[model samples]
Target: MYKKMIKNAAGVILSLSLAIASCGMTVNAQESKDKPSVTSNSLNAGGRVSKNQSGATATTTFSRPGNIRAKAIVYYRLGEDDYHSEDVKTNNAGGTTAFAEKKVSNANVVGAKGEHRVVYGDIIWNDETHIGLTLPNSKLK
Candidate 1:
């Protein structure tokens, strides 16, 4: 009887361990899928929209200060037909590797979804004039 009980308990423990491990893996996968950022060969940028969808904060980081002036632009849509964008500029000081960020507000506008992108007026040594966009994200009510 003692041996039988011990075997059953071990089986239950093993099953619980496997279940917990699978749950952890699922959570990690979902987290990775939701990452929000856009990058270019020379620069990296990202944005975060407010909970109420009234505004967003845009950020830009340079791999190396390539004597370029850049802008982080937040583009958003209202309802289904209205669209708007707001942008902020980098400091433009030469030869500095620092992250630039700006909070763009659209107090009159509110929405549930948007995208972030970076644009540069000056030249990037080996990069396009504008970087790709971040995955569109929805605001939580």
Candidate 2:
């Protein structure tokens, strides 16, 4: 009876271990499926002093094609003006496709101080209609 009990206990332990491991894997798989799909280029400041940088590019790949939007805080210095920040919205019209991308440009150059700087403060994607997770900042050029 003692030997039989030992064997049964070992079997139960093994089964429990397998169940725990499988549960962990299932959670990871679900997380991956829910992850958002988005990519972008570092903010680009364009032209010589007094000229506006065209704009940065954003690329996105969704599991399903749908309209998506992202927001970025753009820090810029135009010509001789003091550096300032603005929140800009960029969008993608998936249009029944799984992939969509856009290059957003603000061509308003208000000064000509011959020097300019562009930095991205923060960027976030829309989980649905509102902002979702904030993306990591990339190295600026």
Provide TM-scores for the models: 0.37, 0.22
What is the alpha-carbon lDDT for the whole of candidate 2? 0.31
- Best-fitting candidate, measured by TM-score? 1
Predicted structure with the largest lDDT when compared to the true one: 1
Q: Write the per-residue lDDT of candidate 2 for residues 1-141, one digit (tens) a residue.
A: 999999999999999999988885645553444232332233322212111243222223232223343322222333333232232332333311111111223322121111112222343222211112222331122
Error of 2 at 129 (Å): 19
Which tens-of-lDDT digit does each residue in 1-141 have in candidate 1?
A: 999999999999999999988885645653454344334443453333332244333333444433343333333444453343544444433322222222344333332122333344564332212222222452321
**Model 2 CA deviation exceeding 4 Å by range:** 1-52, 72-74, 83-141
- Give candidate 2's error at residue 104 in angstroms: 15
